[model samples]
Each structure stands twice: as structure tokens, then as C-alpha cells.
Target: MAKFSVVVVFLLLSPFIDGLRFLVVGGTGRVGGSAGAYLCRLSRAEGYDPSDVTLILGGRSSSSYEASKARISSKLIALGLAVPSIEFLMVDLDTPIVPLTATIESCSPTILIHTAGPFQQRTDPNLLKSAIALNIPYVDVCDEPSLCSKSKALSSTVPAIVGAGIWPGTSAIMATEAVHHLRKFENSGDISFPCDDETIDLSFYTAGTGNAGATIVSATFLLLCQKALTFSNGKKAEIEPWIGSRSVDFGGDVQTKTVRLLDNPDVFTLQSSLSSPNISSRFATSPELWNLLFGAMKTSIPKFILEDKNLMQRLAVFSLPVIRFVDSFVGATNAMRVDVSSKSGNSVTFRVIHDDLEECVGLATASFAYEVLKGMDAGIYYPSDLGEEERKGILERVKKEAVLWDFETSYDK
Candidate 1:
């Protein structure tokens, strides 16, 4: 299963150069490819030589790996950046545990980044577990609650960051900033903002799949079948996904879009970390017809079919032709808005907009990976779990990649 070229060369040469090695699982996919490329670029920017940074793209298909490598090389060339040495490892998530561990061990990565997902159907965090067993620092862009929970359970054994992507990752960081802002304002004045009555609302919008891969589309379909986790008045509740529709103003060119409640892991983590009892995550995609199509799928499609990962993946792949056609006109803009408010009528709003979802997800995940590489305590953590300074650092790093990054505050007497 060890299919990497120059593995021995990397192992023999890496220690002498004080280099950084990243093993990105699902490295050929949209999110993983973007992250891998960003990591190389970031490493170079941080003073590592192009030869000093190594990227091992772990995936099952050599063709995909080749394509991803070419894409990354082209991007680096276009940006006038030196391309790091990249290798491919034949690794498959579906393989048995022992083999998978062996494959990952063969690379001896400094950090492991797991981005391979349609994480909705996975009942276990096998990749995270493998990283833990190997004692490799880990980061993942997981957006699934059960897998995140499973990863969290093993956090004490290893240093890991889960749900470290655009929405769940940066979005959580935004929520934390909002909470901190509100708390600071409260502490500075005589305002009494009770934690129990505070509310956190997350609204997200993307246009035409944001030029993402089928896995993301499949994940969305799977989410449509599940119950959205929300907190109301300090109590947790599960409601039907894609139902409670609301219009959100993303500001700038994104304008106002209609978003519906979606079962995102951020709500759960934010509620716990920020101690905000009322939290909900909502999402929408363009060009309006897509929203209607998703709503119809959520309500009209059978539960079993929607829950079928294979079926969903097939359906997503089948629909990509049409989706790409629509995407051409709609563009690939993505935005997220986090609103934090207290019963006392004080509130903070944070918004992040990116012209490309794939690139933003990569940058966000890379920021987390960058922090983890710098060193953190051994434990699993959500983006909100990061300390104030750490959160600020990640946000600052991501800000450069964002089309819009800003926050506003309002107080009512």
C-alpha cells in the first residue's frame, strides 16, 4: 500500500534540513488539494525553502494525485511561487485499519491533514485515531458532528484540530470573536448580559456549489436528511433541516440571500465554547432555484435515499454537469455571517466573504494546520477552543485570503 515515490528520500533528507512534512489525506480532492497547495505556499512564506517543504498527497488514485500535483504546480507558477516537492501515497480510507496505519506510517509526516470526506456517513474517526496512534499532530476539515465527537473523545491522547475548515473552522472563530467582543463591552460598562439569554446565529451562502467537488454536494444531501442541532433558551433541540428559512444580508456584492437552518457541527461546539444557549447554523446556495431544489429534496425525497451516501455521491456526480453550467453565471462566491446578541439588546455581527469557497476552505484549514505545526497542547479542539491569541492569529492569517473580513457592533437602550 506504500505507493509514494521519494519516500525514502524524504525520510532520509528531511531530518537534516529542519523541514516540515505534511501528509494530506484525500489530497487530490478539492478541499485537500487546496489545503496542500496553501500549506506549501505558507511554508515558503514562513522562510522554508521550496526544497525544505514536502507534501505527501495520500489517496487511492494515482491519476487524481497527478492531476492535483499539476494543478498545484500551475497555481504556484502563476503566482510566481516556488513549488515544493510533492509525492503521492496510495492510501484509501476504505482499507482495513492495519493497512491504513501502515500506509500512513510509511510517510512519517510531521503533521497529518485529513480532508477526505463525505464525513456524514462515517461512524468513526479512523484517520484521527491513526494519527493519534502514530503520535503525529493532526488537523481535519470535518463538518460532521458524530465524527467530530469521536475525534474529541480521543483528543487527550494527541494534539488535533477537528472541524478546521471554512464554515465550521473560521465560522467558529468568528463566533468566538463576537462573544469576546460582546463580553468586553459588557465588562467595560454596566451592561448586564446573561449567558443564558445570549444568542448566536450563523448564516452561510454560496453560489453554485462554490466550485466544490462532489463530496461536498453529497455531504449536503446527507445533511438534508438529518436533524439540525440548535439551542433555544439554554436547551438543545433537533429540528428538521432546511426548514426555518431566514434572509441574511451578507453585505458587499453578496447582498441578501435566503438561508435555511442546516445541521452544522458549529452550533454544538459554539454553544458549549461560547456558552450561548441560543445558537443555530443556516445555509443557502444560488441561484434561488437551487434553494428550491434543495428544499424540495429535503421534503420530497425519501429519508433513506437522502441518507444513502453512495446514492448521494452518484446523484451529486450526475448533477455536476448541470451545476457547473449554472455555476458559470452565478459565480463561486461564498459568505458567512455570525451574529451574537444578548437579551440586554447588545450585539455583534461578524462577516467573512470569499470569492472562492474551495480556496477559502483551503486557506482556513491551512491556518489551523499552521498553528498546529507551531505547537499546541495534546488534545482535540474546535476552532473556538483556541485561546484568544491563537484565534486572533488564525483569523489574521485567513483575513489576507478573504474577499471581505470585518465585524460590527450595535447596542440598544
Candidate 2:
């Protein structure tokens, strides 16, 4: 009878014992590679045996994939963490939907994390659609508006999180928490913080390529050609990109950097989530000369060429040597400041600083994946969609990995 009972228990627990399989598309890239490594680290922290979690690094190039795997293993070993099972799957997102879907299906991943991007030019939510069709949970570091909208449209059909990277991911959560704190203060009757004319300012500074790949450079150049979307008194407006500069204090070694308005999908989601009347996102890069160079390119380069994604990518690749030489000096330090304020002068400020953009983005992305895999309900959701408890949990995890995090409030007396 005892033997039979033990067998039944093992049979019932087999699925859990077998563990989760994660398919990190673009896994060879900085964001994807960091995400996969952090996933392994976080899973180990959760007490899972290293063998229980499997990471399938999906990329088109086998050589790059192998290189990424070896690098990830070395990093994990340096941290004294055991490496999880890592595999490779050949996935070409540029291919037709049929072949891409088939490649994804071959992995049989329990969850799919899409990090491949230069999302600026991608019109179709092909990966999201594939995940829906395959009925696999999905998450992405997409920062593009149209793609995010298309992904959100499919929210009802699948369990997924879009814009799950650092800015659109953790930044969105920070905005939500700021608003919540303000409202809680208002409700306490300490002050009347009306939401009639709320404003949100997102300022970001990434030092020279942030030790990321060429795709980031391509995205930056592409953004230079696009119009920035901002909300003014609850109305939609578009302004020229890389203009409307502001100086923000990130309050650390990265104090007081100049940032110019940039287009980001987070603006749309934050507007809807907080119903803020005015919102804008701005970004800057270090070695100030680079900012000047970007400005010069934006004005001198023909709009058509800058708008051409493939051409811009090629330019970025060609410029990598110069960018890396600069990066060596500026060091990959990154910071973000989210300022939420009301017309009445009540405000909440949240700031995060990290030494490496690639690592922070990966950690933030992995935090979302951890939540989804831990059983977030089936639905398409933004970072703001996370409930209070869920938001706190995710933020806490991010804070642990962040170099510095601070929150402050000021109310007009």
C-alpha cells in the first residue's frame, strides 16, 4: 500500500518536477542573453534545482548562439550560481509566419520571451501571434507603439506581457506606484491631490551604447527620424524627435543629464493607466558629443535614409567600433527618473540607477517572466496592469538588483 501511494504521488508531481522550459528569442543579443542568465539566477533563488529549468536560446546563427551560451555559463559560474540546462533553436523572425511558427513549435517552450527588436520598424506582431497560436505564454521587450497596440489587441486571446524590458517594463510600474502613493495621500485627507491635471515626465540617460549591441544604435537613429508622441492637457500631440530637451537629476553618480523627447510605447500605456493629462518620455546618451552627433545626423541625414530600418542598422553596425571606443570611457552607466505631479504642486519622484543597462534590462525583463511563469492569469497586460501586490513584488525584485533606488514625495503646504 505504501509503495503504491508513493508511485501515485510521483506520477502526480511529475509535471512540476520536470520544470519549465523558456524560449528566449534573440537570446544571443545583449538583452536576451542577460534575460536568460537572470532567469537562471532567479530560478535558482526560488530553490529550483538547476536541472529543473531549461533555457532555449533562440537565434538564427548557431555560432553566435554557442558564443552566448558560453558567455552566460561563465558569468553564472563567476557569480557562484549553477547554470541551468541551455539549448539552442534556430529561429528567423524575418521568415514567413509559417516557418517561424514551426520553428517555435519545435521548442515546445512553456513560455516564450521575445527580445529581438529594432521594433521601431516591425509592423506585424508575428511573434506574439505565433505564441497565441501555439498557446504558449509570452513576454517581450518591445518598445514600439504600433506593435504594442497590436499585441494588446490579442491580450484576450493569450497570456502575455508586452514591453517587458527596463523602461517600458519596470518604468511603467514605477509610474503606477507613484500615482498610487499620491492617491493614497489624497484619500487620507492630508491634501487634495486632484487628478484633473496630472503630469508624468520620464527621463532616461544611457551612457554610450550602454554596452549593448548594434540594434540599440539602430533603434536610436530610427527614433531620431520619427515624431515623438506626447499628451498635452489630455489631447494627443506629435512633436519632432530629439527636441524639447530638459535637464533631470538622476541623483547619483549620474546626476543631472540632459534628455530630449523621444518616442516610446510607455507613453500610451501610462496615459491610459493613470489617465494623466500630460506625459512625455525623453532620453540622452553620454560623452555629450554623441548627443551632438545624433542631433547633427537627425538634421543632416535625409529623412528617408534615417527612416529606412535596414539602412540605419547597417550604419549602426559600421559605427560600432567608434561607439565601443567611447563606451570604454563612459562605461555603460544608466539611470531613469519618473516624476509624477499634479497641477496643485503635489508630486512623487522615483529614481533608479544601474551600472550596466544590459544587465538591468535583463533583470527587469526576467522579473516579469518570473511573475508570468509563477501563474499570472491569462491575458495581455502592461506593467501597469499589474496589481498592487504584484507590482510591489516585481519592483522589490528589481530593486534588489539595482544599484540605487529612491522614492520621494513633496506636497505643497
Candidate 3:
């Protein structure tokens, strides 16, 4: 049979019923949409009676999010999922908060996955505060370091979970696992992270750039060249992001990539959440991706190398295509990986791969959603706060529903 057919066949065979009433705030977006679709499919497979569940997608007018809604709903239908009744709204941060709360209360969904955001745009403190007041479990696939920092600070009265996407979710879990297993990784002098015997410099290749655009790309490259954050003897310090540059073979001739610094929220959260004296959230390059990035870097670097042009200038112009491709890809599906290593050199890696990027995103976001809905009666929390019992279940949830696996790298990079 054809590839699509095989997927459909498998969906038909998979067990489905995990009953819950869900309301997805940014339900039309990739991650939220994928979540809705997954629930619908699960509902279908388990022979969910309509009375058993209701997935109300919370988002703006159809004109604004029709494409996302269509994409998700269509996929759900294809997988033989029940057609969930979608609830559309005219939500903008500027809109009166009263109606938003009222709408939410009306649905009173047992779970709320909030994807709507002024996150990187202008981040609304009101929405977060109000969501917390409502006392319903809420989750956001937020991508903001400043905000993650704030969330880290306010893990008390929030009644909500922030940074619900891949980095904060799956990746955060990875760091937790690494920290949990670290047996006396007390390196107070070690500034470099994951300082294995291998190369420290990673030729980080990226698929997407979040709100910061190529500035992030430049920043990442710069991090490789500068001292990055480190924790030694249970204290934190800064070291060169790439002062310890070296190449480790990703698999094949990936040019033995260099690890570079990235000021992503994941790094901040990993630091905030994990107890690793040395937690570095850097980017790496796969061979194919690196070749592409390197070629772009070359043409632009001739001027910088010979004259007064800067690397950032070169990368910015060169990354025009990268910007478009990555944004679209990120917008299309919320998929990523988080790698964690212990000081004693033991490590495990986890990736949330998707049949579609949306699926991967849904896996990540839903994990956070699950935690919020099922966790203790706390105000606010990050994934790092999770206990060992909760941690195992969260990992299990992803591995079972989404396509996940435990891989053993050859004790290398």
C-alpha cells in the first residue's frame, strides 16, 4: 500500500478511548490542533460515545484561523476520529477579559490548553493572571525566556503551567532525568556543559527560528564563541559557549559539529528547573543541515573576513530563506528534541517526532496539559517541579501516544 494508506491503517488499528473533556485555546494552531485531533482519534479508537468527551477548540474567528482549523479537523476526519464540535471566539488580548472568562466558564472544560499568546509579541500579564484566577488547569506552548523566568518566579499562585511546548515539556523532562541520574557530578570548576570527553563545540544546525528571527541564529553562533552558563559544585557561572569548540560526529561526516550557545527559554528553564550545576542548552548540527548553513555562512563571511563586515550581517542576509522556512516549519508543527547528560557521563536523549510536525507538537503540549490537569493543586509550576512518579508517567505518555523511543548513543556526543 501507499505510505499514507499505511498510516491510516495503523490509526484504524490503534486503541483510542482516553476520555476527557478538553478546551484548546489556540486550538487551531499546529500544536493545539494536533492535540485536538489526537484526542478525537483516541476517542474514536476507544469507541468513545459522544457523551464521553467534548473537545472544544478555543480560538479566534474562522477568517483568522481557518487554515489551521481546516488542517487539524481534516486530519482528524481522515483518521476516522469523531468530528469534535469546535467553539470559535473573537479573542485578542485587547478584548475585554470578562467575556473570555465567561466563555471559558461556560465551557468549563476539565482541561484548558491555552495557545493564544502575546508571548513574543507583547506578552499580556492580564491573560496569565486571569487564567490563574479561573483555577482551571491551563497550558501554553509559550516561547519566551523572560516570561519563562517570570514563570519560574511565580510558580505559586498561577494555577497554570507555562512553556507547555517541546523545549519546556519534553526537553525539560530530559534534563530532569539527567539530573536525577547524575551521581556526584560535582564539577565546580567545569563551566562547559555536558562536558564529556568529546568535542564541546557543536556545529548547531537549526530548522526554525522563533520570534527573534536570525538574531537568534547570530546569537547562537556567538554563544559558540563566548563563555556559556555553567554550574560547578552546585553553583552557577559563565563560560565560553564555544571556547571549548570541537567536533563530534553526529552520526556520519556531519563535519564533527560544534555546539553553540542559544539564549532560548529552554536553556533558562532547564537551568531553573534542573539541579544540574552544569546545564547548557546548546544547538547542534546534523551533517546535511550543517552543509547548508556553512555554505550560506561562507559567501557572507568573505566580506567580514577580509573587511569590516560582521558575522551577524552576513548570517542575517544569508538566512532570509532560513527565516521563512523555519518560521513556516515551526508554525506548521511544534516538534523538537532535548538532550540531557549527567556529570558522571551518563546521558539519555528524547525526541518528539511526528507523523506530522503537528503531532509532535501535540505530544509535547499535551504532556504539559496532562500535568496541569492531573497534577497537584498548585498555583503554577514548571515541568522540573514534577516528582519521580509523575516524571515516569509523563515520559510514558509521550512514548506511548506519540512516536518516541529511548536511544543509547555510543557514550559519545
Instruction: Estimate, for each residue in 1-413, the C-alpha lDDT of model 1 and write its tens digit.
Output: 12132244335655674477899998998889999989987886655677778899988899999999998899889999888889999988988788888889998798899999888979878888888888788999888887887878774545689988888899999998888778777667422344437889999999888887888889998999999999998898999999888989999899899999999999888775666779999999999998898889988889999998999999999998998899899999989999998878899999989999988888888889988765566788988888877798788888997888879999764
TM-scores, one per candidate: 0.93, 0.94, 0.65
Arranged by TM-score with the best first, the candidates are 2, 1, 3
Between prediction 1 and prediction 3, the one with superior TM-score is 1
TM-score of 1: 0.93
Which has the greatest lDDT? 2
Model 3: worst 10 consecutive residues (lDDT sum)? 197-206
lDDT of 3: 0.53
Clashes of 3: 23
For model 2, give the 10-residue run with minimal summed lDDT.
187-196
- Candidate 2 accuracy as lDDT: 0.86
Q: Model 3 — TM-score against the truth? A: 0.65
RMSD in order of candidates = 5.0, 4.6, 10.5
How high is the CA lDDT of each candidate model? 0.85, 0.86, 0.53
Q: Model 1 clash pairs? A: none
Task: Name the weakest run of 10 consecutive residues (lDDT summed) in model 1.
Answer: 1-10
